[model samples]
Target: MKNKYLTLLFGLLLAASSCNDWLNVDSKTILTDEDISQYPELLETQFLSSYDDLRGCIQAIGDGAFSYRQHHLSSFTDDAANNTPWDAGVMSINISPGRVFASIFSQSKGEILTPVWPYKEINKVNKFILQNKDSENSEVQSLVGEAYFIRAYMYFEMVKRYGGVPLYSGSLDHINSINDRATEEASWDYICNCLDSAIVLLPETQKVATEDRDRANRYTALALKSRAMLYAGTIAKYGKVINNGLQGVRADAARDYLIKAADAASQIIQENKYSLSSEFGDLFNGKDEDNNEIIFRFSNVAKTGRQVFHDYWNMPYRVKKAGYTAFMSPVLDIVEQFEKLDGTIQPLDYSAKFSDPADFFAGRDKRLDATIIYPGGEFMGERYSIYRETRVKTASGTKVYAYSNQEDWTNADKVPGHESYMMSGYDGIFPNTSGGGFTNYGFYLKKTLYAVKQLEDYLSAENEQDAVIIRYGEVILNYAEAAIELATSYGETKYLAEAQTAFDQLRDIHGGLPSKTMTIDVVRHERRIDLLYEGFRYWDLKRWRIGTEMHNKQFDALHPILNIDETQSPTAIYYTIERVSAPDYLITRTKWFQERDYYCPVPTDQSPGITQNDGWN
Candidate 1:
């Protein structure tokens, strides 16, 4: 039996590698139904391998150099902006309607920006389910349940991206013969049903010795169901069903889906297995490994070296020695979303001059301090001197010495007084033409960056911080959102009390802010603030039917100017905030998100009967 299992696994893996088309299965290499019936244990090896395939979607990392080394999903959203000019394709396709359709389907650019269809992973999962659905071994049955969860997750990834996609059930032999797209309603239903199966068979908590903790449990399936159902609910309420329900759900079904989302979340909450982490910052910096806040995450055990490259790519230039540093610059638009400690939201007045630019961010939400590196902020035992220009009180009436690049700062003779002042901060808002290693937007991303004391530890792909895929914080927010939508949209007021408790707990525990009355806008603000840069903003905007509205203009950036006057004390030099274009470049293009951009075009080169999504053809 063991030798047979090994042979089947090798043949399946070999066949998977040789086949380019995910749908087409080579009959000679794969396991036959008769072979599976004799050796039911063979499904276990295949089941375990599915987790490896699922990691790509969970980590949000791709095989391409651009995705693995540079681009992040937050950069494609208004939450952050990409500073690297070479990787502008990430932003350009997202912003422009004219280029988006073709760019996503292009073989060269598409793989870098968008996630590839997970039909290959789904195929493996289907085969596992078909053979092991009635296995006599209890463990094999549990593995079959996990297969359902994996299939649901892959379909959710597809449904969210391309609306309705081809849903494959049974083995590869069955899949290869059929080519038809499921309705959007049917796709969402299929995902929810798969989760239902998983919830029934999966254990509440994974056994530490036998099963890996990172693998799916009952609550993990429930958590995903909560998220997926909420997405379907919003699409039904806000989107129009088109092409015979291939793209959207019926409006009347919105309430039922919202209820399912809320119930799934409530079940997890009632179980009381997880809680918010004590320190919000520790969640991402590899400090809170055993914390209850994480429901599901891609674990990065240190010696294995299977870790994320967040610190190497996203850390400010002053901190890291190698790689393209400060790749994502948190724009002012997202920075202002963090409310004050007193629960009053205030926008920064760009027109007003300040004695200190950092003062503009004073007394804001604590999450802001944890999530972004503002000008004059201290990080890794070093202060960020992110100024665009130095204003000196010269004999020639207040000389403004602007630096075009980092090299310009070293020359003292260039300044009027030769005062030996550092022109640009190691962290910067340099001109777009100046080159990489500086932020075009004033702020730097601090969410996923790990603080390394040794400079050598900042090597590419060395940071071992675990990438969080799903956490308790997101589930709490999902519950609050679904309940609030139900109450506000469908007049379902019974869920208000439970929703309010979940909503207030997040803000009070994680954010250290007093809770306000629940509203749709209020829930959304809390969600964005808590989950910033964890890669939820773009999808949230899409599901809410507000992508076109939120991303149709150029984002703003701050330019800090130092007041280096003789009258000012050397230690007490103040800075002023100057509103600048985010890129601050000539021939700047306004980011425009069209309604058609809500669904990415399905590539025409795929299966025969698959109809193209609306506006793509």
Candidate 2:
């Protein structure tokens, strides 16, 4: 097996180094200098490969699966649906190093961990550009432009993950000099400049083939730049917390960049080439192509499956075909944030299990049902219930991990409590081993998973549900957000005009919703519901400096979870009830006080010599 693996890897290297009479390259091949003369095709292929880099890093950093192994630190923060560890549950999250700070730091480290890979890729393409400078192929310039765009994209992510990182533009070699990390401000400026240069060189949408949707185009590059700048600008503009008891960035500078960011994003949205997906659910379906709305995404196919995300979120408690038992549960905080279908904040009592779907959940935003499975919700086109047969392991060596597949109506009294079924049936708690792996109680994610096996191919990595990097809707939202910030910075009412234009664009794409007045609160809310679970919530909250608004509270809820011991044995675990109703634990006002923690302290492990952000102690 080892020999076979080596042979396959060697073949990949050779294919990368040399073109054959067939003019075909293996998918696994790494690019090399020799492939430079091939021009646009080879460079384009390398450009697409950068996306694979994105996929690997993001799933590891952002996706919620395998607990700490796959970072879901945002879940620990208020952005997610907290389900378990009832006693100190949500409050415990405040200091849970593994889930919150550690995960954030790990994501930051991911930026630095494999810098060599992207650096090598950039070098391969750079070689092509250097060798073929005189070539008449107009495609050459575009391809070169794309290569720069790819490098900028990676660096942008790195800077966001870590405040600043080492910048590399040219090919590195044995004799090449290594550079130290740049200051955060300098790194961001360089990234923006690189993107600007690439934009000038890149082809407009008309130049690329349909099959090459994954490659960066001018619009995509601009969209990316808009996003990057928006993030940087917000942090700099609204920055309040002091580092070493010093202010971070001037508000004026922040506003300047924000206006630029808004302008860039507006350019894309104004292009009119992209729009929102017709149905919110369509965005997650793998079978969908790059509709007008999608600016950037992955092309997963059967041969190249990417089902890991769905597998982590669906339930083994219900799906007979699902080999894995555990489902990535939603944190309660996320659930609370969902507005009712009527566009009003859902009443707290409306979350009750027996609440009528028509009255409690009715008139709610369609997105709520589209994303989460609430009590008495329809899943796979059928009425679904969490009360089903379950097995439990007891300490006395009795494993009673079996229960009736019906709602426990026998406990008529408990039904009204709403606590018994809070978890949607599984052992409603975290570290709960209900279905299989470690799970947080409460509801599991079901939207991304397939119901019938027919949709299975599309649900996995093998399916081609493009992992959207940018789109028209996102651009619209950016305009709205940046407009608000710019408005605030300039003390101008026209900011409202900018914000209103963005809102109308989004609603028009969605067949036009009722018009409403503009406010920063409204714009922020729209951005949240518009782009949930795409891993934007955490960062979105951070940029707004609202992390403390979320983190300063404890979330405790009752739910069922599995109990497992060493050796992965299922022992009898008792089903206990818990809830957190304490006002101090549930309310978060700390963000109102110091604000700087919103940026998150850089991981202590990265450099102890560098002080953790002020007030961390």
Candidate 3:
């Protein structure tokens, strides 16, 4: 087995080094210097390989399953929940140092705890940049620029976790030269510089079907730049409590990073190359391709390409032939965050209008409906019903009412002009009943999900749905955040109104919210509503230095229970909010966020002097 693994790895390296008889390098391996210098065209293939791996290919390489880069983080945070208690269980808090350390080990240790120490991907990117840096060919130079963006992106992912990490942009070698960690500020500066170089060389618009959709273009670099700068600025400004990991940027640096964030986003805004599309549901549902709102996304081909796991994510068990236990249900606590549609600062409660059963989903911010499938809400011609078996005696006859598949009552309780049956006779909680992993918190996520007629291939990663990494909606929020921060702290008069203007774009995209203060909390709130299941909530909480606050609390899950009295003229249905874990099923679940969690433990197997984040061993 060891020999076979070595042989496969050797073949991959050889394929990257030299071309075959057909003058095409093997698709399995990446670009090598010999391949890049001898055949400059191979650089494009190698450069794009970084993206392909991060998108669809990373799933197959790292874990046995096709795990996404961002999916794991979503489970740890309050935004989403994974059913199996591996990491998402409410009981698993204060992660053991042994377990936490196991995940942060360097790549050379024969295991990867996380994507932070990505040596293979970086090696290819550095080789391309170094070999093609002096090339006079326009395309080769452009590839080099893209390589810069990729390296910068790699660094941002690393720095966010490890604070200060080793930097590399040149060719790999006998490595005594580049093992030292730079400060957090230095790493971010390097990321910004890479984007600055990319913006200078890459084209403005993605050429229709070819370069624009799959690869990063000029705007792609800017969009990421805006994203990183905003993060740096927030870390600089608000991250005061956990001070051990960050390498001490000056106070002014926070304002400077915010300025860069606002400016970088402003360039994209001024260019008008992208627009906030109103078709929120259709855009993510795979109905529209290369829409105007998407600044950058992974384009996956149907059967030939690797697939994603959107079908199994937060989908209701009611789907025909359901195998995926709804492990990833959207918790009800976050659902109420949506503002009322009347443009008022009212909590999202539809009980008053519950007289109209259909009104359960109406009148709230439309994004809620687009993202979450609540009990009694309709989607894909199927309504997700979470009601109990209700036995009622109508004036005419005895009947049992279920939200779905209503049945006739039996063993009725004799009454005057009315009849009733025991609720225990029928199956209760149509979809919320936990079986095969289907304990939903009364809601399912519809953001990354698409409705399909047949789901036999659903469990397999056979999905061709594109994984969206960054879009204009986030950039707009970033712009709004930076502007709002600068205006509040520094009293920047010019940005006070500009913040409102930028925020208004998102408002119009998802039916406008009522007038509200453009405070940082409000900006943070808007970000959660728009980017809920996209795996940004966890990072947003961390960057805002509010992880501990969120971790200390438990999320509430609502169960829609319907109770009907046969004696009453009309039946009454009630929705009850309850803890997801039943009285006996509860396993002491909690999220005990500590200061050390701010920075993941540094890989001990790396440099000797590399320190762990403040707390861990």
Candidate with best TM-score = 1
Error (Å) of candidate 1 at residue 327 is 2.3
| Predicted candidate 3 versus true structure: per-residue lDDT over 1-617, tens digit per residue | 54554454455567554222211223233545565566554455435657754452222111222343213345556765544344332224334332221132122324333323554556667766766678787877777777777777777777776677777775444342234777788878888898898888777765444547567788889998999999989888877523343543556789989989988888888788888878787667666657888877665457336565554544555553454354565665677777778655454453442433335556788888888777667677875555444545456775654432122212322322334433422222433323333443556667767664445655555446665677888888898899899998977656557667768768867656655668888888888888877767766776777777855556656555444444564555444323354222322124446656667666554345665556666
Residues 235-334, model 1: lDDT tens digits: 9999989978889899999999999999999998889888987588888877675678887766553633455555567777677754466767788888
Which has the greatest lDDT? 1
Judging by TM-score, tell me the better candidate of 1 and 3: 1
Each candidate: RMSD: 3.8, 10.2, 6.8
Off by over 4 Å in 1: 1-43, 58-69, 87-92, 98-116, 174-178, 209-213, 301-307, 349-357, 394-396, 409-420, 452-461, 568-572, 584-589
Query: Looking at model 2, which ten-residue stretch has the lowest summed lDDT?
Result: 582-591
TM-score of decoy 3: 0.81
Error of 2 at 341 (Å): 5.2
Against the true structure, candidate 1 reaches a TM-score of: 0.89
Judged by lDDT against the true structure, how good is candidate 3?
Answer: 0.61
Model 2: lDDT of residue 150 = 68
